[model samples]
Target chain A: MQLTNRSKQVSNKEMTMAEKMYLPSIVQGLAITIKHFFMKKPTIQYPEVKRYLGPVFRGHHVLKRDEQGRERCTACGLCAVACPAEAISMVAAERKKGEENLYREEKYAAVYEINMLRCIFCGLCEEACPKQAVYLRHDRMVPVFLERDDIVYGKDKLVERLDDRYVRMNSEVKATPTEPSLTKAAT
Target chain B: MDLTVLLVKGLIILVIFGITLLIATYSTYAERKVAAFLQDRLGPNRAGPFGLLQPIADAGKMFFKEDFIPAQASKWLFILGPCLAMLTALMSSAVIPFGDSIRLAWDGTNYDIPMQAIEINIGVLYIFGVVSLGVYGIMVGGWASNNKFSLLGAIRAASQNISYEIALGLSLIAILMMTGSLSLRAIVNEQATFFEWNVFTQPLGFIIFLTCAFAECNRTPFDLPECETELVGGYHTEYSSMKLGFYLFAEYINMFVSSAFISSLYFGGYHYPFMNAVHDGLTGSLGEIAGHNIATAIGTVVFFAKIFFFIFFFMWVRWTIPRFRYDQLMNLGWKSLIPLSILNVVVTGAGLLYDIKYTTWLIVVVMVVLALTSNARAPKSQAAPQRA
Candidate 1:
C-alpha cells in the first residue's frame, strides 16, 4: 500500500536555560542594529545613475539580416516548432526570380508572427532556430505598447538593425532573463 | 486684542510644519544619495539641479497616479490608516524646540524671540503618547487590506510595536529620572554641555532609546512585520497611487519624528558648545527672554543635526541587516529587552539613591552578565530527531 503525506516526526526537546532567558540574543540583536546604524548605507539610484549589467541581458528582439540585406531565415519552421507556448508561426514563400538578394535561402518566411501574449520570453525560440535569424538582446528597452497586438511582432515590425543611435543595452535594463544554463541562440 | 499672541503661535506652527516636512522629504533624497554613495555609485543627478526636484516630481507622480482601492478592503479604514500615519508623524513636532530665538530690532525695541513650536511642559510624555499611536496606522492598513498576508503582517506589527513600546517607555523613565522634567525644551536646557547630554550620563538610556527607535520606526532586523519576502507588500499590499505614497512618506516622516525625539532626549536638543557665551545672558525681562530664545534657536539646529544623524542611521541599518524570524523577534522584545530594561531601571534607581556615577560601567557590566547568563538559560531545542 502506498502512503500519502508523511507524518511530521517529533523533534527532541532540550532547551537550555540560557536560551530560555532570551535577553542576550535580544541585546546581541540590538548591538547588531547599533553597529548597522553607525555603518554606511548601500542603495543604488537608477536612471541618472548607472550600474554594470551582467553578460546575458535579453533586452529586445533583433532580426539579423545578411550583409547584402537578405533575410537569414531558411523557412525551417524550427523556431515556431520549438516555442513552448505556440507563440511563433511563419509562412514560407519561394524566392521570386532575380530576387536572391532579399532571400538567403530558396524559401524564406514571407509572413512571420509572434503572439507576444502567449510568449513566455524564454529565448527557447532563439535557441531552436536553425538559421541565425531571431535574437533577443543588445537593444534598449523593449518598448511597451498600449495594445497587445502592437507587441505581437509581424514581419513588418522586424528591423534588420537598430536605428542610427544604436547602443548596446545593459543587462540591468534588459528583461528578466530565463535560465542561463541553456543560454544559446540557434545558428 | 490677543490676536498678536495667537498669530505668533500660528506662525511658529507653520514654520515648524514647513521645515520638518521639508527636512523629511529631503531626507528621503539624502537616504537614496547616501545609499548610492556607500555602494560606490553616483546618485540622482537629474530632475532639476542635483536632483533637488526629485521629491516634488515624485509627489506629483503619486498624486496623478490612478488611486486603486482593493475590492475586499474597508474603504473608510483604508483611507483613515494613512491619514493617521501622517498625523502621528507630524504630531511629534509640536513639542520640539527648533533653536534659540534671535532678537528682532524693530522700531528700536529689539524684542526677544521664542524657539519652540509650542512650549508644552509635558512635551516628553506627549511625544511618547503620540508616537505609540503610529502603530494604529499599520494595524488598520494591514487589517483593512483583507489579505491573509496583510492580516498576518498587521498582527506582527501590532505585537512588535507593543513589545518595543515597553522598552521605549522604560528607557524614557530612566531619562526622566536623570533630568527630573518631561518638557523637551527643559530637557535640552538641562543638557548645556556635551557631558550633560543623556548620551554621556545615561548611556544605557541612550542605547535603549536608540534600539527602541529602530523598533518603533520598524527599521531592519526588527522589520519582520513589513517583511517583503513572504508578506509581499505587507500592510499596504492592496494600496496603490497616493495611498501607497502616503504609507511610504509616512515612513520617512516617522524617521524624522524619531530623530527629533532621540535628539531631544539623548543627544541634547539643539544645544551646541559654548552657546551661552555666543549669546550673552539676558538681564531684564526682555533680556532674559532674549537669552533663552537664542538658546532655543541654537538648540533647534542642534536637535535637527542629531535627528538627521539618526535618519542617516536608519538608512544605514536598513542596508546592513536582514530581517529576524517571527519567534526570534518576539523573544528579543518580550524576553530580552523588557527584562534587561527593567533591571536597568532598578539599578538606575539604586544608583540615583546612592549618588553613584559610572553608569556607563554599570550598564556594561549588566550587559556582559546578561550575555553570559542568557547562554546558560537557552530555550529548549527544537531539533528534529534523526531519521533512520
Candidate 2:
C-alpha cells in the first residue's frame, strides 16, 4: 500500500475590515442554523419505535425440528466443528426402540448447548449444518444475563417449540433427502 | 402615599415580581428548547407535554439537592454570592414599564394604575447601577471558592464587565442625547410610534448597546468568564447544589431584564403601528373606559412580543457565534465599540443641534458608508475551503 501526503499549508493572512466586523458572517451563520432549526429531526424514540432489521440479520440460534415433531439434528457435529468460538457443544445418542417418534433418525443430539457470550452471530454454524438443523433467528435476540452460566443456552432454550412459526417454516425439511427413509427407519 | 394608593402600588409590585420570576423560569426552558431546535433535536420533553412544566421540575431538583461548600471556603460570602446575584437580577425589572396606564373601576371609584413597579425619575440610571452590582455576585462567589480557576473566572468577568460597561454607557449617551431624559418612561414616550423607535434614529448606538448587553449578560460570544473549555465552570466551579443553581438561574433573569430593557429603550417600548387608530376605533365602538383597558392590554402584549423576539435573538446568536478570545473581547469592547460609540455621540449631538430629522439621515448615511466600505475591502481571493 502506498501512503500519500494529506497535509496542506494553512493561510495566516490577517482578517480584512469585513472579517473584523464579524456581523455579516455571524448573520449568515445564524441564517444557516435557523434553516437547520426547521429541518426534520432524525430521532428514533427507542422501545416504542423499533427500527426495521434487514432479512439477513443474524440474531439468536434456534434448533430446528421436522414435520413429525422430531429432532432434525443427526448429531453429525458439523455445526460444533464450524463454530469458530467453540460456542456449540452437543452429546450424541442412539435412538432407543420406544423413542422412534422423538428421533427423526437413529442418531439424535441428547444435550445441545451454545454459549451466547462466545457466539459472534457469524452464521457459520448455520452455513455448516448440512442437515439444516440449526439457524440464526431473524426476529429473536439473545437476552443479556448477569451470570455466565445463565448465558450458556442449553437444549431447553435452543430447541424451538413445535408450534413456533420458525418450526412450521422448517417443517419443509422433512422432504429433504438427508432425512432417513421413514418406513425403513421405522422397521 | 395615600393608604389606597399604597395598597394598589404594593399589589402591582407583587404581580410584577411574580411575572418576572415566572418569565425567568420559563426563559431557561426556552433557552434549552431553542438551543435544541437550532441543532435539530428535541429538548426536555419528558417533564411535561412539550416540557411546559420543566422549570417546575428543575426548581424541585435544585431544592432537593444537597447544598455543599468547599472545606476551605468562606461559607458566608459563598452563600451571599448567589443571593446578591439573584437579588440584583430581580431588582432592575422594577423600573421597566410593561404597558400604559389601565383604569380600574373598584367600588364605583376609578383609579388609574401604571404598569411599572417604581416610576423613578432616574429609571435608566437605577437600572445601570443594579446591573453593575451583578458583578459582585460573580466576584464574591469566585473569590470565596479559594480555587485558582474560580479566581481566573472572576477576574475575567470583572474586567469584561468593566470594559463593556464603558461602551454600554457611551452608546446609551447617544440615545439619552436624543431622548433628552434619563427616565425610561420618557424615553418610551418619545418613541410613541413604531418607526420612531430609537433603533431607527440611533442604529449605531443600538448595535453598540446590544453588543455590550451580550457582554453584560456574559453570553456568547462574550461569555469568556464561563467558557467551559478554558475555566471549567468558571466562577461557579466550586459552587454546587442550589448555590450553583442560583448563579445559573440569575443568568436567565439577567437575560430577561436586559431583553426588557432593550425592548423598552430602543424598540418603541409598547408602541405599535396604528395603535392610536385601533384605540380610537375601539373607543368609538365601546365606552372610553373599556376601550382604554383593551388598548393597554394590546400594548402590553406587543411589548412582551418584542421582549420575546429579543430573547430568541439572544439564543439564536448564542447558537451561531463562538466565544471571543480574551484579547479579542477586550479589543472589541475598548477599541472598536467605545470609539464607535464616541463617534455616534458626536454625530448624534451635531445632528440634533442642526435638526432632529438630520440626525436620522446622517446615521443612515454613516451606516451605509461603513457597510459599503467594509464590503469593498474584503479579500477577493479567499474562497471557503471545501470539506474533505
Which residue pairs in candidate 2 collide?
A: none
Q: lDDT of model 1 at residue A174?
A: 31
Reproduced native contacts, each prediction: 0.15, 0.61
Candidate 2 local distance difference test against the native: 0.86
How high is the TM-score of chain A in each model? Answer: 0.61, 0.77
Q: State which candidate has the highest lDDT.
A: 2
Q: Candidate 1: lDDT over CA atoms?
A: 0.74
Please write out the lDDT profile of model 1 over residues B49-152, one tens digit for every residue. Answer: 88889889888998999898888889999899888888898888888777756455555656544566778889988887888898899899988888988888
lDDT by residue (B83-162, candidate 2, tens digit) is: 99999999989999889877777788777778789898899999999999999999999999999999899999999999
lDDT of each: 0.74, 0.86
Residue A59 in candidate 2 has what lDDT? 82
Q: Score the docking of each candidate (DockQ).
A: 0.11, 0.36
